[model samples]
Target: MSDTFSPRTLGILGGGQLAQMLALAAIPLGVRVVALEPDPQAGARLCAEHLCVPYTDPAGLARLAKCDAVTLEFENVPLEALDFLEGRVPVRPGRGLLAHSKHRAREKEGLRAAGAGTADFAVIEAESDLAGALAQLGGQGILKTSELGYDGKGQRRVQSDAELRAAWDDLGRVPCVLEGLVPFTREVSLGVARTASGNLAFGPLVENVHRDGILRTSVYTGGDQRAEAQAREIARAVAEAWGLEGLMTLEFFELPGGELLVNEVAPRVHNSGHLTQDGGGVSQFAAQVRAVLGLPLQGWKPPLPTAMVNVVGVDGLDGQALEPDWGAIDALPGTQIHLYHKAHRQGRKLGHVNLTAPDAETLRSRLAELERLIP
Candidate 1:
């Protein structure tokens, strides 16, 4: 919490590309990162010191508690694990934020309570609640599990009572939320970082394109002053309302009338913000590290139009077949490629490329060329 701080240790609770990137960002600041993850092959292990243990392992938690502060890469980390580390060491954007964001019902409630616009939704605890909830949502809705849903997993679109029943049964009859679908023009996300002292920094509003519910590309499209202001306002409000002390991302559905409806919240660095690494003055990972350490936030918009494309593993391909043509991608101008050291699996994120150009047309041309070369 001091301005005159020196190199220190930081703890991360998950080990994915997000954690890996966070670790990489912290390196230049002289901060050492220790990541606790059960997977030995976790990409984060490439940069940070690895604990290599279950998150529930007491010894692992104890090791994490010894660090200067703790944070998480993914929102799905157990609340109990966070609770255990709460007072022992600083846990920025703590358990309360995690709990609120992890459950679909609670996240929507929090958004409503904050006076933020969100789609109409109802909680469904049983099959009987499905029809009524769908009816409340105007007969078409997305049935999503209350927890552990991501990238289109644990969700089903239902327009009929029969489909609703099947969706409920398919999801193991768990508690769910039936949300009305928004007639959105495009999906944009705002990434904001805040410190315990309330200092804030925002990344550019990114327009995202998704394939099979997985984010395919995030393009920096911030020339619209009105829309940009609204997006930043929504992000700041959510951060303050949640008393957040680290990075948080708000995914919004921009309506045809220019109204923004909060769609989801990720209580940590988000995939949509991946372009920040090359596009923004301060990357989300760097801002997160600064915030958790109680340092002042610093950032500015990118000088050029930038686009990020996710390299996802193709379905029905083994690890060898899933290998991308990295050589070809690296040949493009003003392009930065990041490959996460992860084993190839169906639909898994393998890497991403950040492309920057003097103008949107040039960026689009480069992206099209890259797409053709990707295997």
Candidate 2:
């Protein structure tokens, strides 16, 4: 805390949970955050100043350009908006990496170009492209829109031509990528933060479990030397290639026997990394704000090993208040809960619980109990 601090303003492009957390982290550092989002009720509204305009609003962009720097919570920011901001203010992770992460096909190409392995794939821009894409991908593949897809949406599994066609139709036949589904035993993600000056901080390679394609739990058990090393190497390569600053997360499919293939990348804070906030050390949100502002970034190692379980609402629930008993969560040993302060909806990520323990087995046992309690 000895470093000299200055009051500064940071502009954020989205007002979702990630931006909300970033605003919370910035408040302690004497930095102010302003967020642009179309939704007036966005999660970040509680923590930051809101510009309730579309991402590309000229007045909004002009106002945002006045901040000391700019960053985004999600990858779907329009390229024109970045171009506008890039000409006026500093945009962390910059246009190159954002462009790469926004499109699935382009992202995979960038990953492979950065020396990370990925699923074999081909683009399916139309129905006529489906047959050749399937044949090339070996008769079965996952069809996903090349853009604006997240949280298990806009993607489907297809093992036959009829299903592929149906899946594409279901997805509105948008520009898509048909990928050979990875055969893997585990899915994991690594989050890394890099400063504008090129110093890097890598989070642990945590194991992830998903339900219906949305992450439900992320556990940090540690001690996978092979996977850890691979994740770091790929992170370094991609950061170096794209001249990355701020945070970028690499999600990987860990094949049996410790081999890892890149699955996806998010150029901002990620859901899987939420455990970083409660691990008895500096959180990823603070690290991201530091990185983009060219401040010194502390290493990612947290004091207590921890795990997180998402608080996801079930279907048929929207506009309903989840007035759960916080006393119950507070009573649990070494447990903390984070609620997004938003209304509930089916399959929506409302918050997460972080559980800490002295060792992996104890942490896992606590995590299971926490999951059941939250549901």
Superposed model 1: Cα runs more than 4 Å off: 1-3, 315-323
List lDDT for all candidates, in order.
0.87, 0.86
TM-score between candidate 1 and the true structure:
0.95
Q: After TM-score superposition, what is the CA distance of residue 131 in candidate 1 from its true location, in Å?
A: 3.7
Q: Judged by lDDT against the true structure, how good is candidate 1? A: 0.87
Model 1 is weakest, by summed lDDT over 10 consecutive residues, at 315-324
Candidate 2, residues 96-195, lDDT tens digits: the string is 8887899998999898888899999988886678766787878998999999999889999999889999999999989899999788999999988898
TM-score of each: 0.95, 0.94
Note the residue pairs that clash in candidate 2.
Answer: none
